[model samples]
Target: MTDTTAFDWRSFLLNWSGEWADSLPGGETRSEGDEDARRARWLGFPPASEERIAAAEERLGRRMPPSYREFLKVSDGWRHAGGFVWLLAGTEDAHWHDNESGLADMFEEHLDEDAGPEERQEADIWRRGLQLDVESDITHVLMDPEDVDENGEWAVYTWASWRAAPPERHADFLAFMRDMYREFHSLRAHRRDGEPEFANDTTRKLDAQVAQARSAALRGDWERAGKELDEAKGYGRPRAAGLGDQIRRLLGQTYMVYFEGLVTDPRYAPELLPPLVAEHAAHSYRDDSTLTFHLRGAGEDLVSLAYATLERVRAGTYRYTAAGPFGTAVERARELARWGGTDEAWRTLIDALPLWEPLGPDHLAPLGWVADPVLGPLLTPERGRELLSTPRGGRTGEAPRPTAGLDPGGLAWLAEPDPGDNPTSYRFVLVEGAAPEELPERLADGNGGGDGDGTVLNERLTLWEARRRLLHGRREFSSYDDRALVAVGRAGSGWSFAFDGDPAAFDRRRFVSPAASASAGSDTRAVVVWSGLRARHGEPFFHLSVARGGAEQYAFTYADEEVRSRGRIPQALDPSRFFGDGEDGAEAERSLLEAVAGEFGVRLPRHAIVNGRLHTFTTRSWTRPPGDGETYAVIHLRGEADRPADDDRTADDDRTADDGQGSR
Candidate 1:
């Protein structure tokens, strides 16, 4: 028998058998020898006599490692060491690896002159190592006698062909066996078969550890919880694996977590399932890392049921039946969904998540509802962003809404311009004391100028035609070259107008404000206004920024019914008053434009912008910096630039001129 004070081999074997029984299905009786062997694999064979061990040692001319000998005193051999390894050899079967398999010849033949000392040592060790595994699936367990330590324990290695990795080394046979036991647990954790009840003391001890870890996690002692769960997991407890994953996710170490085993009890399913389903659906297609549910057994069926229920919720045919805060929240969400207020309903559910409590120790409560059956299908992807867009405990107060309006003054034309197919998305940069002809140069210098040979072309076209040409350039050459086009002209007496049709251009507050500041001449003021009639998601947006003396003075943006402002916004141009209380998004946007135009004393003649000609230039404002080992090529497509003679100067020519000027 093994010394209980050291390693209790009998108890370890018993725990291993219990875990094996819990994982694998039972009741199939095989023929005599096969059945006996299979039974012995789990329960283990009787301990070998001292005389038998001595006879085997005399035959092999080497004494067995202390741990291996002690293990033999408990059980002669082991079986199913892990997923890959099969039967471990007993005294009667153990032999030298090289003598039996002759694989040392293959290792020597492949050994290179440049092989490192460690590699050479590994190859030589394999040649004389004692084999511990008598049967395996392309796997071998070896003990190196020459690598004995002070304790007289030989170094052990587990090599598998399918791994394509070097042999995994362990300090001794005991350590190898312990790792194998842990591997068995990890592999079995994913099984679809039922987990049988483990009545063993070791299992009870591990389960208790997991329970304590859960309590610790709830008390916010996450570090302690993680350590405890990690320890329990080492003993092959599936509950520990599940709880550890949850702790990792809660601590922000990972974005995904998983639950194993069957979860069909109605008491627990409601509290446990929604978050897992939602998180799984949310990150299913994520590119960075694989996030999965890890659901097995009846858990799979439960997920399928949840999906069906979600479809019913979307169809307005499902009703939550349970009582309590969560059920009430669900009902509220259902009512909102029925009334076409899905986003509001989703918010209602999300707000109530913190109040959710677990029904059992195994359940993790208050997960996101983005994938909940009753709310997930109703929540649009755009709205679902609310689930993780902000840090936990960081959100407070109601979202900002547009409640103010700005007076149009002399710039009323901006609020009511010619509408049909007019460039709805555009930006205007107006610099005082900068002539119309010099506006392009100022902007080119402010932004990082392009890189190409000097070639400048001046053309005049209506704002509509200019926008079309810019869009055409974007579609045609965007694959090889990043480019944009801007129409420059005199807006009023002292303001030079630079307009871009791309809505996203100068959309970023930092970029637009800095660009405006850079465009201002010494002691001169510059103003930039960006307006988008309808974004890709159908939301209108407006932004205004003012710069003076080579620095930005004020900036404001109003989008998605929210306002963001920085610096000292003039009271006359306060975005809160830029829109009337009853105004829709489009009207609000127009009102904001009028307010900006009036504040900056900027006015663009409608007739000139709509029909008259204006000087247009191509800019490389959107070109991305080249990555490592990356080069760019410019290809001018034939028949694509077939515009009027006045529009002959392509974006490429202006980029080359800008590049030349920037170089100087």
Candidate 2:
């Protein structure tokens, strides 16, 4: 029950005509080059005459609602992008069941099958419907007059042909309009945290470039505008698209490859434009906003759209739509990728960050998709796992692992060997009752005697809790100063070794990108780490550690991000990626080498693994080394195929942990 009087038709119309859509809801139908021309070139049909409006109502055997009827009188039909419509048919074109572009036709096709009892009852009359014209081919806006009552307002329902479930129901047209308005802004804005700021010089340069693009578009200069768009898109900002869209709308020429041999291979004996892709033609435009990748124009628009996704993803401001055409403009850029060839494909895969939805699953996940030559080469299956999983998991596990197969759409990964032990799962002990120097080599099985000082309790933990502690840090250990993290894993098939070190030394996230190796083939094996090492580079590899509290003792591991999050890690995620995390190939090599040895051993890499925060304790402080001495010495694990014999190191280097981090 919306208060109709509260409607701001003026505001709605002003926003609707935004740089496109040529009147319609933003204003009555207006042609391009009119007094107040903006970016869009599409036009709206002439308003319905009184007789025509009455005839439409008479044909339907029901009086038109006042508001909707008034709207139609302003513009009978429209061809536009942005405000939830691609084509708003006039009364003559409206139909109850025409497959090509009929709203009622779509409704019947997905009606009862995807509707609940109430919804089905409402659709039985087939009152009215409109297509949303999003990236996906099958979705629509429907109105049920049966339940309208004398108030003349009808509840609106959205039908997505891709959905096998009930259509989404909104209270009425106003509600639906509100939702579309929000989507419109979001599509244009992308990130809500505000436009990314540039440094003084970059800002001035980009601002100038954007103004030039705008100026060129205003004067109808497509060529100059495009070059400006090219330069601006290279930087992180949304303005580039807005400006380019303006120029594109002004040009008014879209070359659909199917209709025109634009990208056809001249190399082919019978050269022809690539085969038609009419399957998703519905995705070409937004009712009121300008289109990217629309009509197979210059693929640069798709490139800009894709790159924008990366900026938002890295900045931690991405949000998937509540109702997806299933895929986003960024996701749809894959088509643009193919249309534009290898370069466009590469650009889209990198910045678009295509997602995977396992068959039967409606939601998309960032990782676990099988390797695309471009995507696979660029990312690991676990690369953006944390960013994609919704509702987010706890920070209590060892780290997330690739839970599926390479072909994201296929179920082959399910048939593969379970990677066995997860790296994130750990059973460690944080000794609160003992000083850092007083704990035994085996804290879990300790005799329980140490130079007591401030150590007040012994907290043994499941790996999940251990992970939580690593992510959370010493917040819970504030009352007691000394703590030891005994991160555990099996080193060899025959013998298991525990990493006796400080929690401060273990960080799953590091500045150095671990060189990601090739993905694991079907034959790849999962090896256990008795907690002595993290794979080289980005991994939380293991090493022996010793910290000073009252006494000098070994500690285990923890995760730290490059940015200090204070606990909220996502906000601290790297704004720009520093790639490379030790890969599937490294794990395979380690497994093969271990199998070849067929013996018990553990070894250390050349890097020092210990990390800590320095505390300025008094000269007499028990945790400090009696005087102005540095923290305790960090030893190296003595075994495990020592390829680099000099790999081991002592804390003599005096290095420490960086601020923020992540999981697989």
**Root-mean-square deviation per candidate:** 17.4, 24.8
**Which residue runs of candidate 1 sit more than 4 Å off their true CA positions?**
1-5, 14-27, 31-55, 79-86, 99-125, 162-166, 181-198, 234-236, 250-360, 363-664
TM agreement with the true structure for every prediction: 0.47, 0.29
Q: Give the alpha carbon lDDT tens digit for every residue of 41-83 in model 2.
A: 3244567898998887787676655555655666675454233
Give the residue spans of candidate 2 off by over 4 A: 5-11, 21-45, 49-51, 81-84, 97-139, 147-151, 158-170, 175-433, 436-461, 464-664
Least accurate 10 contiguous residues by lDDT in model 1: 400-409
Q: Local error of candidate 1 at 528, Å?
A: 11
C-alpha local distance difference test of each model: 0.60, 0.34
Name the lDDT of candidate 2.
0.34
